[model samples]
Target chain A: MAATASLQTAPVPEGAPITVCEVGPRDGFQIEAAFIPTAKKIEIINALFASGIRAMQVTSFVSPRAVPQLADAEAVLAGIDRPEGALITALIPNLKGAERAAGCGVDAVHTVVSASETHNLKNVNRSIDASLKDFEAVFTLLDNSGIAVEGGIATAFGCPFEGIVPPEQVARIAKRYQDLGATSVGLGDTTGMATPATVRAAVRAIRAEAPGLGIGLHFHNTRGVGLACVMTGLAEGVTHYDASVGGLGGCPFAAGATGNICTEDLIYLLNESGYDTGVDLDRLVGAARLTQATLGRELPGQVLKSGPRLRRYDPGLTATAAG
Target chain B: MAATASLQTAPVPEGAPITVCEVGPRDGFQIEAAFIPTAKKIEIINALFASGIRAMQVTSFVSPRAVPQLADAEAVLAGIDRPEGALITALIPNLKGAERAAGCGVDAVHTVVSASETHNLKNVNRSIDASLKDFEAVFTLLDNSGIAVEGGIATAFGCPFEGIVPPEQVARIAKRYQDLGATSVGLGDTTGMATPATVRAAVRAIRAEAPGLGIGLHFHNTRGVGLACVMTGLAEGVTHYDASVGGLGGCPFAAGATGNICTEDLIYLLNESGYDTGVDLDRLVGAARLTQATLGRELPGQVLKSGPRLRRYDPGLTATAAG
Candidate 1:
């Protein structure tokens, strides 16, 4: 009875559209061993935009020496057609990267601060405190640039180096981001260690600490609970999510980490659950196919492999209806 | 506030241990292309038992011509060491298979009825009504055998040919099984089209139709929502779940059907969410390894590849504490 009651209470309200922030260009491609040509990256980003993804993390403005794969970030930013009203964001690590992203005219710049000190050091070559200090300067750079700042706390759910990050610690970091002029903050399951319980607890903690700040969830399917975590996040009223096109991307530092939540898969789930994602399933699958072609490999995405469940075929029904 | 309230109400009740019914030996091996030796099958079942799986579907007593993979059901049943208090179940197609399973000393026999008439014809080479008629004789054979009966309704969520299966149809079939002397009924997502909403609706419908009957859920990771469906099932208070070691098992008839939910992955989720599965993670991983070795291919299970998340290692803490 309690279970049924809970289900009734958490029903997805009619026509409540959720925003799926595509991170394939940034998160998904960052781990590639070979450098994807700048033109190809632009083509994929434009394809995603055509597929009705209005919000996306296009590329990261990091040191070329650090991540050679994303070395053409500036070229990609300049080459792609940025449709009016689209929110194009870029990941920035420090003040220099933020300045570079701002100059590239991104709608928003995302900065990262891991909850675990070890992970933060491994990810950005700086401690969490040092990253926060760096963010102060980065935030100052975007003060009058019309660029929104988003703070992403990596390893917010669980860390590869520091497992089972405390919800209080994540809350504190999120609250600090709010205090530092971030428009929103995202909880990153860096190693895909997030369970439904952990996702719910993190949401509650973050919401409690920063009441009006927008919260997004970034999940990986490494241990195969990415979408489950997303479901919990949805029940917690989280409408923003970060996903890759073909379930691409893996954490280089985290052992066994593989693939963010697949974009088409997440969109399929949202659409089936009666949430409007504004993304066309067919076009999205096309983009996923392009991603596979660009990478010249099979992707981990399912919808691209298995098309959406069609309506039942009736012999009496016309071919048009069946089609 | 509503999201937080919903989460609080649905918190996994303290100390409510969930039963994970391991179906790897039956479901996993049934899909293998190679004929696994009877001794290897028994060895895997024993290894699963050693991993603290108290209940398992060991083998299927189907026609050897129909499914040669499970032809050695009697040999596997006779060879394995059936631990005390373990529920050793076997799949039975009809009266003959049920009689064979009963004679072979299986603690229970599972019979399947597809909700979709098309799938029923394809699977059992009989109509739904014909299967029901056959079940009558099978029930009579088990009338006083002291062996329990479990009815598995395939395509209870959706069918490959029929597409969406109405909740009422699944409920009607489940109620029929309950009326025909089944101790419990499992709703099989044969084509993996089940969403959280559908799962909740099916649970509600079945509970309404067959009050006080045990309900179990069988899911496929075809579209990568198997674990998510499991989460929704857990929220709806359905404890018993069917999973395969190494994520083995695929519906040969269902297009694009992939592996079943991995046993180790499911155990990891249950354990992290505070549900006692009575399964040792290490031993279960070992069993998954054995499954891979027997199959001679990599399986889809993740926890078998990625170890459980360990706590943050502190330099001040001892190695044992860190470990």
Candidate 2:
């Protein structure tokens, strides 16, 4: 029977708005081969905004020739109409990318550094120290441009090359970013090698080291543990999450890496658990469907295919709880 | 970084041995057209036993014509030698089936009942009460027969025809079975429609009503939430999970349901998290590989395809902790 009183006793402090930072348009499109039209990118962002996704990573400001899929980043950013109270973000690899993102009138600029020295060299062709030095310039550029800057640590959980990243190394890089005046830090399981226990340990260690910093998570469901890690983050008192629409994303290092946790499905999960995420599941699914059609392939997010559980059922068959 | 003082804390008292019960040779083979040789089943069972899988739902003692795949159940059981500590289980539908299972000299006889009246009617062409009445005869036949009896609650999570199942209904049936002196209760999510929240609620309610009953879980990863549900069961202190070796089972109702969670991967998660499941990953993966070759189709288990996380690295490059 449906409990007359809800069994949801674990209450978070009242009136905390959990932020769902959308990374699909940037992260999702980057990995896929389909060179989506700039208009399609704008359309997807507009759709996300309509579905109550206020903050979105619209496009990456990387070198156009480097990432041809998002070559029209500036054009796409300019094409989408910004609804009221919406924040658009972009990824910046270096000072040049930061300048490009700041010029696009985006709300925030995200720069990333890999925790593993091997992955760091492969990712950006620079050592960890050299990447940090490069980021110093990117940080100064974003700081002078009056735009919010966020530091993302990729391969934070475990590295495909190095394997089993030590927590102290991740914390050390995070601390360095915090000292460099980053507004927030995003931890990425770039290869999806994290388990719940590892996630818990990492979160505990990071919180002990950097208590005041705003922390977010970017997880790829490569090994199918992305959602579990997300739950661990929830248990660790994290309120902000990063997800790609249609679960679209891939690791450059690991072959056959799966998509990120689907944004539509994640929204459905959070909203069903009495967490207010503001995103409309149906609208998100519609955008996901559009993206799937544009890509000409099936995406990994199951909720879009199966539909949400509670939404499909007739109220007469299942008992509704008395509020 | 490794804690200077080896962060290996005192082992938390393991709640109970989470039975990685295998039902593949029975439940998995029954629906397939592939007539696996009797020797193959014996080989599979012997490999599973070697992997420290103590309890195995080896075969179903159904009529030969009804399930031709398991028609050689008797021969398969006779061919395999049971390890001293293993609980070799056989599924029984009625008194005749129980007698047949007893003739096979198995450790336990498992019987199933549907909580939804409509599903019970459709499945066995009998009402819920009629099925329960049949259970009475089976229970009477097994009493003092030196064989343990376990009851399975199928479609406990959600039914295709009836939709959502209430916790009270699940608990009431479990209570009835426990009151009738069932040795254990196994909850089956036949349709894979359960979320972690629903699992937590239903399991808690059942435990509250049927205290001291050995509760086990049989989850299908059809909806991609199977592992998440497993994590929920772990948190709620429920051990004894039933999984197919290569996630082999399928749903008759849902057209393209995903298979059960892979046993090797499940053991990898549990063992890596410091739970003493005692299953050797390499042996289990070898068995999975053999099954895949015998079936001539790729299985859904990740570790079988990609190997474990440690397998990703070269032996020379891997650290001792990961090894």
Candidate 3:
């Protein structure tokens, strides 16, 4: 009943390995109004990988008519360099998208369904059962192609249209995905209604029902608790988190709000908190700068604007304020 | 050797009261570029008090020519309405500032000294020991006046001019504050160089050195992990935290950055995380809107734009993208 119910969690060991999955190419670019050039998208994706991002959702395999921004997904997948042992993934909505991704060089595909029934209908014009049934076809096509499947439960924390989603619902869906031979399940906080309470509830419920399924958390910074939620995830023994370069996306409901948590900031937090994310902080910031230069505006990343924690300044500079 | 040394902290109980100290009037307004009218500052401070802010750093008693924006500290303290059992405080720089606060209706005075010698010299043109020596007179006057003293240690986590401040340095100054009969001490993240490793080390050292002194944390969101650092503070059992309304302050060194952690967002996180701060979320958001309207532009607060967590939207609203 309380958010602090799961406060007594295991300590993440010093140098504990964590997987920071980059979802900017798919989740961030999909919502961007202007179409990012195909070559620029590949350049940013390659830069992120070169910075030691082993797992990334590079692009979405969707119809060009629907999301014009991600129309060149196939070309991007073909043109990008693959670092050894890197796992490139993409978002697939249906069997057709799955087939397209199979022809590309993607190692995995993330399939999504909304946990809220109302939101499920609003998002995909279908019921939860219908969406799950459709995923079966996607699973069959991908399984035959020997591609990994990551079940995504959107609105897993709270729904914007209908608030206070039940944890049992998320668990029940995760169990279904587990039965469908999925490798992992991602809890997506779309629209950023997640708090420590909902995150703990969903995670605990899924652990009980789908004990074999791996858990990943994808949070947006819409209400500004994204990284705080990440802290709780670490305490709860969740090691995989999704982040976007430059905090690129935005919520339609909240103006001037950032969508995904920033990549460089996450790395800085993890490295300082005794976790080994295996990502270079400076290289990640360089990629963020590249994205910012391409977009021609300041992103919502704080560490991007300010250098790392130990960065020194000239003693001659004027001190601004008393603490 | 690790930042996770204090990860095995006890849980903060449900309905456990947390002290949310509002520091925007002093910390945020003093650095604002324009001179906010004295009446307008009072209106915002009174509105914040009406929203159940029990403690506040109302203004700074500095020279008018130095920080003209907060020149009306006396007027602002007199004009604001005080709730029952409210503790109104002010930043006192010297014996003169303490005498001014003693005459005004201030419950307490916060005297500051930087832990880093270079920063202390740059900020106040004095060495750390000399600054501490000067505070002795201010403490004497305030002690006689029955005003509480909260000693502040600037650059407690790290310093910009001198990177990687030693936790022992912070503990030494905090012990000095204890000797001076201070009730509580604040660890200031001056220049936003704080991290979980540094926060843990400093809090642990202070607990060992001066167990009697109550601890308060003042963190800037300049590095995007301000709330994440607050998570570390909670794990360390540090309860009182200082935040600014509408994220009003800015880092002079880092462009496009915010200074203090936003007060409304902190309240929301605490409330959801099973702590009772005795502040209404909607009312706090309302106060932020008032501040934003008065400033004639948007503030950096996300909850101010997004509303509360359980806020519902129209189901008819279109979903922008698949999760």
DockQ of every model listed? 0.29, 0.18, 0.77
* Candidate 1 error regions (>4 Å): A1-14, A253-257, A311-323, B1-14, B253-257, B311-323
Of models 1 and 2, which has the larger TM-score?
Answer: 1
Give me the overall lDDT of model 3. 0.85
Q: Alpha carbon lDDT of residue A36, candidate 1?
A: 92
- Residues B1-323, candidate 2: write the lDDT tens digits: 00000111122234334568877777777767879999987888888888788678898887788778888878998999799878888888789999888998987888888877766766666877788778998888888887887877877887766788898888888888877768577888876667777787778778778776667778776656677777777777766778888878775433444566668767766776667676888888888888877788877675675556644554244221000
Candidate 3 residue runs with Cα over 4 Å from true position: A1-9, B1-11
The superposed Cα distance between candidate 1 and the true structure at residue B98, in angstroms, equals 0.7
Error of 2 at B135 (Å): 0.7
Best by TM-score: 3
Clashing pairs in 3: none
- Scored by lDDT, the top model is 3
After superposition, candidate 2 runs with Cα above 4 Å error: A1-17, A81-83, A144-146, A252-257, A310-323, B1-16, B252-254, B312-323
For candidate 1, write residues B1-323 as lDDT tens digits. Answer: 00010111143463566778888888878767799988888888999999998788898988899779989898999899888777888888889999899999988888888888877876667888888878989999998788888887888888777788889998888788878887788778776678877888888888888886677888878777788888787777777888889888874433444568889889988888888788998899898999899889888787777667563444332211000
Q: Please, what are the lDDT tens digits per residue for candidate 3 over residues B98-186? A: 98988897888889899999999998999999999999998777766768888889999888888989999899998998898886788
Clashing pairs in 2: A1-B168, B18-B240, B19-B240
